[model samples]
Target chain A: MRMPVVRTIIGVLSLVSVIVTVILGLFITPPDVVQGNLARLLYVHPPVAWVAYLAYGVTSLASGLYLWKPTRSMRWDQIAASSAEVGVVFTALTLVTGSIWGRPAWGVWWTWDARLTTTAILLVLYLGYLALRRVQVSREKRAKRSAIAALIAFIDVPIVHESVNWWRTLHQGATVASIGTNSKIHGIMAWTLLLGFIAFTLVYVWMVILRYEVTVTEDAIEALNISAWTLERENEIGSLSDEIAGLLSDNKDRTGTSSSKVR
Target chain B: MISESIAVAIKDLRVERRSKVGLNQVLPFSLVVVLLFGFSLNTQSRVLTTIAPGLFWVAITFSSLYLISRTMRLERENGALDGLFLLGISSVSIFIGKLLALLLTIFVLEVIQIAAVVILFSVHFESIALICISTILATVGIGTVGLIYGSLASDDRLGESLVPLLVLPILAPIIIAATNCWSDALGNHGGLGDPWLVLLTVFAIVFLTVGVSSFGAILED
Candidate 1:
């Protein structure tokens, strides 16, 4: 359903929650015993990374649906491309916030570690998918091609993670299992982190909704242009046919008069 | 299907033979990439030796970008793609055929490149079998995946730039796994039959299957 009201509600809810998350995370939430102010990024990085993963997952799922025969549609392709673009944005943000947090915590802006490297590759991979979508092909052709690319990319992610994991001998801590659920993080800090996740996810939903609407409108306009061109051509052809018919009748009338006069 | 693929492979090889672009042009370009690497990374033989295996694969991969595009470009430019369809060759057969041709060309390029690396970088690899296996497996994976993107991007104007951007990220695992395997073979840092080999083998098989199955869809205009 194209529920404008729901989209607006989501937009407002996300904005309010994000502002609340910032207030709680920046000021209200207590600093960590160890990382201190750096821990405030805890409310930002993980949630954003989570949304990035979420976006890719949605992109892959939508691409899958598009590729499958029973569910094939350009809308799914639109969804896949839109989600991938948003995913690329969030993935970049994840890297930025991560390294911003990392420079203080890990003493470096970037590390060639597994998760970080995988996320970086993830960003590039979807960016490539976005590039493929931008190729000027017919809608169906673009959809099929990009869907295949997206699915290949989706499958490649785990393999990319695995290969990078094998390549790396170091660890990035158990940030995976511990985020948003660590017993050490409790009360306001935990609440704020949860709020951050929900807020960012809501924002992602709103963004994808708007992006999807834009693509739909674009395709509609393109279809309208094609139809208008077709109609104009048809009118031109119709007038030419009318002229041909009139000329044929005039010639016939002239021939008939000449034949009758000769007879 | 096998015979058709072989026929298609032969046609591609013939086209390359007549064109001489692979040897006369791309070979020099790749070797120059090696020379450029030596130029940029310091002229010390020690550093070049240390990075020789990776430099070898990087050069090969770089050349394959052109080779892949070139392999498809002639057929596309000449409109032989549709002609192949009319020849009763299935898309799978055509995919396999082009992949085989690309792999053969890559193998030749890799051989020459390794020789260049050995001469220029003063590198000695301990495990010949390991090098051969890793090279074969990695190229298969890369070629299979490359053809998929080659067909997609090669038929367009932005293809030359777009191929590397689209293909490289997906092939990251292959590059990583193959580089490690080669490092172990050359540097004696690891043992044989490591997980890297397994990753390479799996990458090859997976993409081959993916390439074979999806060729029909991707080949459709």
Candidate 2:
């Protein structure tokens, strides 16, 4: 019931999408009319942000599951941890690709614009969540504590989304959905970006599943190893003490015989 | 429960009074922040007038962060929060009482910080009551969420990084409103137009309700 066929299909599809996206990402999408090659960073940046949001959604689902069930089961905990890890990676990629794009587009590597600042803060929050998990001793405690943190952090996501709209800041509002905007992205660029978004999402899902499986297997292995070692130690303690006591008894019997002979 | 809430708040105040830890931590940082702004801008009065609200709020935000983090740490580190939970008082009352105490601390800090700024930047206070009320509305929102997230972040060792993440995004609306209100107050542009106060008041209510209801979940194992 491991569903090897399903995993295989997913793996193959993931690879095919990655290959197609990379091809489109590299050659097919036209460069920015204004920023030139630097705008190419958008090919990665938007998809990365998309994956970050996807990961946060996963975190929320896992959090709700944890709160509702309250089980010792590692499944929900593993999913939460893996989603956070993947989210952190995506957030980092967004920031890096954003700065790279900024270098050419904004004439600086960084800007204190609302979008950039909120995005950076989101990245930091998840990074902190991951770091916090490392310091806790018990898995249950870590997961519960992090579940609460994740919930709080999730609340901030909508706020971050609205920061640009709420505040008068340097960051421009929604790029694609803005009304009366004639930026008219070429068909090729839109298709390629959409493909890249799908591809990145597939990668994010794969990583989470793989990471969760690793955690489950690791826990199982640890439990197995612990039982095995305890069994060995129990057997050693059983036979070694008996052997020593038996030797003493045999010596005492021989001493009794010697005493009888002496008598 | 009300008595217990006061006890908790007074316990915090007594310790802070004795050590001056929270007070001292905020005053200097806020002063230096305002002074740094002065040095950077020098004599750009127009720019100063324009950005003063933001600078004032930024100073207020960072200073309140310091106070909230310190107060939460005192409870968390000593396991006082757990003790309070065991006493079977309403979490909402605990939240309100702690918020009351924290607002006092934040208000005093803001007053002193803004005083320093007013001295340095020559800010004209056309309506002190308006600034104070707007600040109270804004800080109520900030502290409500701040205490919730402050307590949330206390469990994690990443308090330093976590507090701001849990705060600034929530702080956005209040900061915007207060910034608009303050600049309007200073420019004699006629009192923040009731709409902004209405918005701040609504935001404060929402955060308070959310903070009080969800806080117990934050403390759960």
Query: Among all windows of ten consecutive residues in candidate 1 chain A, which has the lowest summed lDDT?
Result: A169-178
Candidate 1 wrongly placed segments (more than 4 Å): A169-171, A176-181, A238-263
Best by lDDT: 1
Any residue pairs clashing in model 2, and if so which? none
Model 2 chain A worst lDDT window (10 residues): A173-182
Q: Across residues A1-263, which tens digit of lDDT does each residue of candidate 1 receive?
A: 55578888899999999999999999998879998899998899889999999999999999999999999988899999889989999999999998898898889999999999999999899888888888887888889898999988987888899999987845456554675676777788877888999999999999998898898899999999999999999999999999999999999999999999999
Separately for all candidates shown, the number of backbone clashes (residues 3 or more apart, or on different chains) is 0, 0
- What ranges in model 2 sit over 4 Å off? A1-9, A28-43, A69-74, A102-114, A169-189, A217-263, B1-3, B39-50, B127-129, B155-177, B190-199
What are the per-model DockQ values? 0.73, 0.21
lDDT of 2 by residue, A1-263 (tens): 47455556667777899899877877777777876766666667888888997898898778768867655455787888889898989989989988888877789999877778778778877876776566534567667767766776786556544544455467555565442343566577777777778788888878787777777787789789989999999999999999999999999999999999999
On TM-score, the leading prediction is 1
Model 1 DockQ class: medium
Clashing pairs in 1: none
